[model samples]
Each structure stands twice: as structure tokens, then as C-alpha cells.
Target: MSSDLQGDGGPDRPHAQTEGPAPGAAPTPPARRRRNSYRSLTSRLLSADAWVDTALWRAGRTIGEGMRSYDRFLRRFEVRGFSRAAAELGSDGATFGLLGLLVLLTFAQPAFEATRNADWMTTEDFAVTFLDRFGKEVGRRGIVLNDTVPLEEIPDVLVKATLATEDRRFFEHFGIDIFGTSRAMVENLRARTVVQGGSSLTQQLAKNLFLSNERTLERKVKEAFLALWLEANLSKRQILKLYLDRAYMGGGVFGVTAASEFYFRKNVRELSLAESAMLAGLYKAPTKYAPHINLPAARARANEVLTNMVQSGFMTEGQVIGARRNPAIAVDRSQDQAPDFFLDWAFDEVKKLSRRNPALARDRIVTVRTTLDPALQRQAEQSVDSVLTEFGQARRTREAALVAMVPDGSVRAMVGGRDYGKSQFNRAVDALRQPGSSFKPFVYITAFLNGYSLASVVPDAPVSIGNWSPRNYSRGYAGPITLKEALTRSINTVPVRLSIAVGRPAIIATAYKMGITHELQNTVSLPLGASDVSVIDMTASYAAFANGGLKATPYAILEVRNSAGQILYDRSRNEPEPERILPADKVGELNDILINAVENGTGRRAMVDGVAVAGKTGTTSAYRDAWFVGYTGNFVSAVWFGNDDFSPTDRVTGGTLPALAWQKLMAYAHAGIELTPMPGVDPARLKPAQVARTGDGTPAATQPRILSTRTAEVLGRIGRSLDALGQTASAGEGVAQP
Candidate 1:
């Protein structure tokens, strides 16, 4: 380095460096000078900070001025438009005011309050009629009611599922949710339709409680106001309870309890998760989502609700999936059988009871436990159906009715027509057609009461009363026939002679005593069923024989109960000491004869397997009506066949059609019951004429005869006419009138 320096003449150049500082030589400076230079540079940078702050301040001021100017311009424009809008709005203000007044007045009615309370009377409940619980009558319909339940009694699954399905934010939101409403509005606007509803449960309750189903802005506004008011005034539980109680489910169900019973045939508290989901889904569209209408669609909607429940944290995923796999539940529709007629009959009686005691006519649900055995009614219907069907096939007879009752006046079953749905007219209680030869039983009963015995011989030849000549159904008379044969064969002339001897008035009185309330003509032909009477009256009259001469007024309802489970009335026992109209011995004689009529008389076709049936057959003039009234030891039944329009039909007799119906009915009625033998008449009390001829050498007069005087006379006349034509009377006897 020293040699390089020597070569570069560094030592010698020291003097030159010192002289003027060589071209590349460094200059030496004082420390204070360096510090001063650094301070000056810092000062310049610090000064530049002021300019930056000033420029920013001026820019912000300019932006502020521009914003003020824009705001002033907007205010001026808005003021002008608002003033014109105010003028236009002022013109329509009075119209809106009047509309508001009208709306307020309309909604202010007391009926609105009553509707909100769900208070309205039904026509049948308010009617004035003394109807037997079993008797068919007018202005009667079944009961429908609104059932309320406690909040806790409502299933938790239903609540959670309903919220999940209908409105998930029900718990957190007020009566109206702005966010949900906004979303609904935007969705509606985008679709250009009203496909979604944003109503809360409160709003729904408001609509159901106080408004008709009218869609309008004013109605919506009122609904909203009411909903808000409800939200503030009532707790969430109360609102939900009201909704559940008052909401209308389809199929005549008006509340959750009723809906639960209607759909599941179970209590609301018994609903499972899947059932709860289905009921929840019904809230959106009850008719559409009803399980009865569309089970698959209802299940799909229910599954969606279950999924929503899981998503909304109301139910777990596992629970929801389990609910989805559950089977669909439904009520047993069979239980809702032909209750309309029974309920109609029951309500009519309830009205009468209520009329007797107006205090019982309160606005409460009443349960009427009736004497009607559904099974018996069904049997009666089937029996009539089978008879009518068979008769229609065999004899072209398409009309018939049947009434069955206990001898104690309890109506067991009734069939008013071939099809109750097609025609609800109850012919059993209303039709008053002639009873024909069935009336002869009452005549004979009168004769027996007047001391005529079963063996008493009566003239069966042609008989004349003034201008009227009575002939036997069989033209040729079996002269001097026993009274038993006269009734058994339903002979016309013999009954005429018996009626003449006993007096028609006595026959009429006997009919009245046996529960024949209808008026009977005091004519010679009345004993031959010339009087018109209802099937019910005739059946009841016949029942007196079965009940040992005690007359029971036909009644239907056994008891009536209110919604609160109070027994308003009950008919568990007989009303009082029954009205006794005939002596025991007389009734016994008639019953024996009637039983003989079924065993070997015109009503022989009415016999059933292992059953002892007593009955009489009747065929009206011109074959307008056919009737059979009968009874077992435990039950009595009546059947009638006729045209409703009162037109003539082919010669159809009670023995042919009505007796068959009675047989079919008794066959079913006594299906499992043991057959008990009817108590026969006491021989010790029998008179000489009342003794029947046995195979042993007894008197021929004592033998039972099946032909009446009129029928025997008519048969003899035909036989005589045929004899003139070279045909014997014996060959024509079998060709007597039915």
C-alpha cells in the first residue's frame, strides 16, 4: 500500500491536497454544521405538512357547500309536488272519511260480537214440537258444536308443527313482522300474484272471529289492527287457544277438539307426531289438505311440516324422520252411520223437553243418549232392503217400510223407505193407508173381550149391511166356521158379522185401548181394515198384546245431556204406571189367536227359524197398501208396502210381501237369541166354544178354522159361479183374493 502510495505520489501530494483539496478528495465538516443541515431539512418537511392539511380542509368545505345546494334544490321541488298532492288528497278525504264511518258502523253491530263469540241458535234446537225420541218428525237435525280446550291440553307436537309449517317466527314476532311482510310483498310483486300469505296466527284469529271472508284493503287494515290489539291484550297462549277452538276444519268440524275427533277419532291430546303434522298442515288449506280428501297430498304436506320442524329447531331430525315414516291415521267413517234420522228424531224430543222447561234451552251442547240400537236399525234396513229387492225381482214391488218395537213401547228399528237418502219422508209415521184384514185382530179382540170364545162359530156366507155387501176373499163361504179359523184365514164376511155382533163402536174402543190413537170409523166395514192408520200406530197397537195389555207410547230418546255433562232428562224406566187398557185374559186370547195366525193362518209366511211370531196381514182395497204387524215375546215389528203417490199397484197382499219382510226381519232380530214359546191360553178358563178340536174325538166346532165369513162367502159365490160354468167350487177355492 506504501509503495502504491509512493507511486501515486500521495506523500508528496499531501501539500497539493492541502492547497486546494484534490478533485476527488473528501471535505471535512464540523459536527454542529451537520446537525444544523439535518434540522433545516426536517423543518422543510414539517412545513410541507401544513400545506397538505390546508388543501384537505378546503376540499372538505367545497364538498359541504355542494351538498347544501343539492339539498336546497330537492326541498324546493318536493315542496311544490307535496302541495299539489295535498290538494288532491284533500278532495278525497271526505269520501274516505265516510267510508271509514260506514265500515266502523257496520262492524259495530252486536251480531259481530256474537259471531266473535260463536253464539248462534240452530233451527231444530229452537223449534216447538213434542216428538218422541224414537218418533220421526219434521224440523229435526243432528247437533254440531264448538269445543274449547285448555292450552296445556293442546299437544306440544301440534303447536311446534303448526308453527313450523305455518309461521316459523311466530314466537319471536309481534302481530306483524316487517321483514316477513317485506319478503312476502316482494315475492308477490315479482310473481304479480298473491300466492303467499303473511298473516300471523293472531291475524288469522282476528279474521275468523270478527270478519266475513272478504279480501280487501280495508278488511286487511282492520284485520291488522285487530291482530295487533289481540297481541297486546291477550297472551300468546290465549290467542292460540282461541284460534284452535274457533278455527274451522272441514267436514263439519269447528275446533281442534272436534277436528281431532273427526280426523283421528281420538282426543287432541292423543295425537302422535305424524298426526300432529297432518293437523298442522290443515291450517293452510283445510279442505285441500284434509286427509279424507287427499291422503297422499296431506302426507306430503305433513312431511314438509316435519322437515320444517327439524330445520326450525322445534323437533330433532331423527324425530322428524320417524314422523315421516309413521302411518297415516284416520277416523272410522262407519261410526257416522245413518245418524241423521236418529239425531233428527232425538232433537225433536229435546225441543219438546226444552219447551216444557225453557231453562234446558240454553246455548250448551247436549248429548242425547237414545234408545236406538244402531245394530238393530242396520238389521231393520237390511231386512227391508232384502225384502224389497226380492219382491221387486219376484213381484215388481219397489216400495216398502218396516217398524220394529218392543212390546213396552220401545221402537227398536225403522226403515221409512227403500232408500232413506233418496227420500227422507218417514212413511212409518206419516202414511195412513187402510190396514185391510190386519184390522180384524182388533175386531176379534173386541169380540173376545165381549165374551166370544176362540171356538165360537160365526156365519161365513155372503153378508149384506144396508147397500154394502161383504163377501169372503174366497168367494165360496165356509159356513159356520170357528172364530179362530175366521181370523186365521182373514175371512171378510165373518169379520163383518163379528163386527156387526160386537158393534163397530166396541171394536173402535178396543183399538183405542190397545194404543190406536188414530181415528177409526164406526162403520160395518171398519173391522175389515176399512180405516186408515199409520204403520207405527198399528205396530204399537199390536205390541200391546205382547206386553200383557200395557200400552207404551212409542219414544225414541232415552236421555239428553248438556255439554257440561249434565243430564237434562232421562227415560231409563217407564214414565209412570203404564196405561192398562185391556184385561189379561182378553189380551191372552188375542195373542193366542194372533200367534195361531202366524202359525197356520194368512200370516204363515211370517214365521222365522226357531222364533214364535204372532202377526196379522192386511191388504187394502184395490191393493193400494200392504201391511203386516207382528210381535215376538220380546219385540214387535210392522212392515208396509205401497206406492208413495197413492196409485194402484198389482194385487199385492200383506200376507205375500209384508209378511215376508216381517219374517226376514225377525230372522235377523232373533239371530242369536233363544226362541221362547209363547204362553198359550189357559184351558181351564176356556168356554165351550173356545175349545179347539183335538185328533181325539172332540167336537168339530172346537177345531181351528182359518177362513173368515166374508172370504168364505166370496169363495162360495165364486164356486157357485164356476159351478154354473161346469167348474167345481173346490177347484176355485185356492184361487181366492190374496
Candidate 2:
């Protein structure tokens, strides 16, 4: 266009192109030039220098004009476009749209999954109900409610009980409890949590049926909206019924009706006051108040529920006491006799599985079938209670633990403490106590495994190893005794010498290989029960002896499955062969010696009337702990008696209480079952008659022949020696235990 605009006309530009049009000069007319002459045009066109100069001048002018336009556009027009767009997008309306987008995403996921609920709860992961090994419903995973009760079908007491506990102002509030939620907001702000939900029944139904259970402000806000939607659509009775049908109870149980049938093994129509109170209390923390896991806590929760019921004018105080008069139906020996202890262990395993999988069918419910014998569990509890009540009165000790397992090492029964109501600590699995002479079997087993003869005699003399000197419980040593006799009599000096001869490391290996997992001190006293171990370990180790010397791992869970019937875990599937720790021949020999201990030595109190018994007694220093670990061909069990505080008792030797407790448990456990002899030890080789029990309750030896005069003289001399040593040396106190 203009020459000044196209070219650098300022003073700073001295080398402007001379090829361009001259400033302020008119160009030649093309028509007149073309008409001048073909000859002149041809000559001018034919000159290559003239053509190149004309093209260069036009290209320079075109580029200069384009640069000026781009420079003007970048700073003036495009910058303003971006600023205007940002202002519009950052406005409140735009923010609202973004929030709406997030809400759609959050709700859309749950809504999409819900539309496909044509399948049963079984189709959900880990949502199917689990049954016991017998195929009876034990518990459920997920929201599996088989019996969907109507509002009319629900008991009045149950409705009031639930309303009193979960949401007292349910009928009063619209959807959300305004006052309650406001209070929860203030408290949560202080604690920084979704701690106190303070949700109404409708709100709970909304969250349970259609929510991710994610604890975030976005989820909470969505939950509030859904609750309001539920309130607007459904009646109050419909919402309450839905909540009752969808609530998650402990033991993977769901719904009021299913929980009624699961815990009480009865229909909702037949529920007792006590059962109703219990079901209502399960809302807050189902696992914590599960009657089987912790009866006392469950009872306490039920008591609170009953109190709520009374305060709400639903029931009287008299009715509350009467309802609680009978223990819940689950643990009633006359009714269910549930394996509460084993259930606790199995539930713990399910929890471990839940941790590995974040989305475990909401509330982490998974069907787990366990190996538990209800009959043996009952017998064990009775035996422990009877013994503690009778014998423990003097010791003033309130703690005891026991575990019983089959020859295959599947745990059948476990009692963590004397009374589960008083404590929840599982001593059988968790508590570590000195095993005392109960551990001697491992030392002798080490020797036996290494080719030491059971009949070989070891010198029983005063022993002083390093700075440690150990005296016989009763004065005067046996001088020389066979290994069988040494073990049968439980002599301290004998096992100490045997353990040292075999080497402590070998003993430790045998202990570990036999299933003793507790850390063992590498000192000389390792053989004398100086190391502490749980009753479960002792019982599991003894299973090797019962099952013909195979190393067995104690397990309670036998099968785990998801809702789709997929085998998530199976103990017997693709099972590996167990390790053979001791030869069957060696096991029989050990059995023979242990049987003799029960029949003739300190374990006499453990002898049963018709069955052959094999066991060992243990008493730690200062009577801090006592133990009896033993086994039949079919079962192995360990019992411990002591105070939780680790205080000395009234010298409650293992032989005195633990052995007696073992006898009581085995007597009932063996009833109606065919007795079998130990492997490799024929029953035909024993005496003609079974051992007898005197009126004083002391077991009579099977060997009927009277004591020989020579034996009597030897015992008489030993008595004199003991007398000379002073009464501090008790006559009946075994060498190892006392």
C-alpha cells in the first residue's frame, strides 16, 4: 500500500532496497506498455536479470506488510480473548457446574451398579452366607438376608429396641436428625472424622443400600441428598423395614431376621426378649459385641439396649432382668453350645483377608467354614470351670487356658481363659508361659529321634552346670534310672543331663521342628521349661505324637469361599504332605512312657477309667505356671493354670489341677466314641485290666502285684533321706515340677 508503511523509511535504515517502488512516485501503466511493441516486451522478458529483479522486489514488500499485522494482533486481540474466557469460566456459575459434574460421577457409579441387582446377594463378592462344615448356616458375608420380614412381621419389642438404640427420634425427624447431625458436625470438627454419623433410619438405609462407604465430604453430601430422596419417596415404616433387612450384624450376619436365625437358630417370630435385645445392640459394632467373641461385652451391650428400651417406655426394668436371666441361645449348653472360642479365631482370619482386599463386599463380610467341634468345646469349658472352681479357690488364680486339636492338627476346641466374660485375651494362642516339665518331652524326643534308646539309663545325680546347681525336688537322687523311668517320674536332673548330652541346639531344633514357635533362650535351662510358650503351641506340638509323628500345623479355618462359590482358600486343596518328625516306632515308645506317667507317676490324676492315657505334668518355679500336655491317638490337648498377673499360686502343681482338668475334659470328650490304641503300641501288650481309681480319687496302677520287700526297703530308705533333708522337700512333688 503506502511505501513508508511497506519499507524502513526511518533514518536508522540506510540500506533500503532500491528495487522497490520509489517513495511517493506513480507506477507505469501496464496497458500502454503492453501496447508499445511485442518486440520490446519480448526483449525485456528475455533478459534473465530483469525478471529476477522484478520478482525480488514484490516478495520483500509482501513479507514486510504481514510482519506488521502479526505484531499488532498478538498484544491487542488474542490476549483479551483469553482473559475474557478465564473470567467467565472462573465465575460462580461455572464452579457450580463443576461441582454438579463431580456429584454425577460419585452417584453414577453406585447407581449403575444398583440397576443390575437382579442377581441375589450371593452374586456379590463375599456376600454369600457361610455355613459350618456340616452345611448349616454359620454366618453371612454381605447384605444377605434370607428372611425379609414385613413391618407387621417384626416384633414390637424389636422395633422399639432398634428405635431406642439406633435412632430414638426416627419418627420425629424428617430424614436427617438435624440436632443430632449438628452435634455430630461439631464433634467431628474437633475430632476430624466421620466419627458420629447420627443418621436416621432412612439415612442409614440410603447409605447401606446405595453408597461406597467412602468417608469424604463429597460422599457425605451425596448421602444426605439420597436420604432426603428416600424420605420423599418411601413411608417411614418402609424405610425402617429396609434398614432392618439391610443392617450388618457380627459373624457376617445381616438383617434382623437372619441374625435371629443365625445366633439363636430360631425364627424372628420365636425370638425371646434376651435375643431381641442382643440383636438390637449389634448395630454399633457387630464384631465387638458378638456373644461368641466376648460374652461379657455382648451382655453389657444388651444391657445398654435393655436400658434404652426401658427409658423409651418400651419395656419395664423387671422384664429386662428376666430377659437377661437366661444366657443368649448361642452358648446355652442345653441349646446350641456354640464353639465361641473357635469362632473368634475364624473371624480373625476373615479380618486378615478383608485387609488385603479393600472392596470386600462392603463391611468386609466373607464366608468362612471352620473346623470346630461343639461337643468338645462344651466339655472343655465345663472341665476348666469345674477344676478352677474346686482347686483354684486356694490358689486365688483366676486365669487358665486350654486347646484341643485332632491328630491332623485341626483345632477343635479352645478356651482362652477360665471365663470369657471376665477376659477376652486368648491365652491359648497369645499368652506365653513357662511350660516347666511339660517341655521335657521335646528333649527326650530329640534324643529319641537321634537314635538314643528309650530304655537306656541316665545317671540321676546332683547336677551343677556352670554357675547353676539344680537339686531334686525331693532329696536324694535315684542314682541311675532308665530314660523311660526318668521321663515317667519327671526327674529334673535326668532331663537336664539328657538335654546336655543331646546338645541344646539339637533340642531347640526338635522343639522348632515339632511346632514350638516361641523364642527359646539358648541357656542350659531350656530343657527345664525355662522358655515360655502358648498352650496352642504345646497342643499343636503334641499332635505330632498323636498322629504317628507327623509335624502338624494347627488350623481352625478349613474353607474360605466368595459369593460366587469360588474357592478363595482351601486347606485340603492341593495339600502338601506333612513332614515326618519322629518314627512311628519312636512315637509308640514315647507314648508308652507317657502312659506310664499317667498310670504310675505324677500324672496319675489324669488317668481315665477305660482309655489308655499318655501325658506329662509341668510346674514352673514359684508356681508361676503349671501345664499338662497330652494326647490320645485321636486328639491332643494342653492345659495351663496360673494367674494373669504372673504371681505365685498356692503351689498348684500341674499334676494337681492341670492333670485333673485334663482327665475331666477327656472323660466327657471320649464318651460314645470308639477307643483306639496308639499306633505301633498294641493294646494287647498291656495289662489284662484297666487302671482303677480309689474312692479318694487317686488312680490305681494297672500293675496289680504288690510292691516287693526290696522296693519297700528302697522307698523306706528314700523316705528317711527325704526326712533328713527336711519337710521343705515334699514327698509327692516330682523332681522336675517342684
Q: Which structure among the candidates has the greatest TM-score?
A: 2
* Poorest 10 consecutive residues by lDDT, candidate 2: 700-709
Which lDDT tens digits does candidate 2 get at residues 229-323? 77887788878887887887765456887788777788887777788888898888887887766678888888888998989787788878887
lDDT at position 243, candidate 1: 75
The whole-model lDDT of each prediction reads 0.71, 0.75
Query: After TM-score superposition, what is the CA distance of residue 584 in candidate 2 from its true location, in Å?
Result: 3.0
**What is candidate 1's lDDT per residue for 1-738, written digit by digit as tens?**
566557554756575454555667666567867998999999998889988889899999998999999998877866457787896788699889989868765664433453343333232323122222332221223323323457787889988887776667776788876677788788999999986678877888888866666787667777776777678877887777777766666543556777787789888888998888888888877767778766788898888888889988987997677777885677645334453444444555666666565546664455554556556677677767766776664565677877788777777677777764345566887677888888888888888888898889988888899999988777788989998888888888888888788788888888887777888878767878888888888888887788777877777766555655455665644257678887778787777788788888888778764456788888888888888889877688889988888766677888887877777666655644433334454433222222222112232121122232235335644754665565444457666643
State the lDDT at 578 in candidate 1.
77
What's the lDDT for candidate 1? Answer: 0.71
Model 1 misplaced stretches (Cα beyond 4 Å):
1-140, 143-336, 357-359, 362-364, 674-738
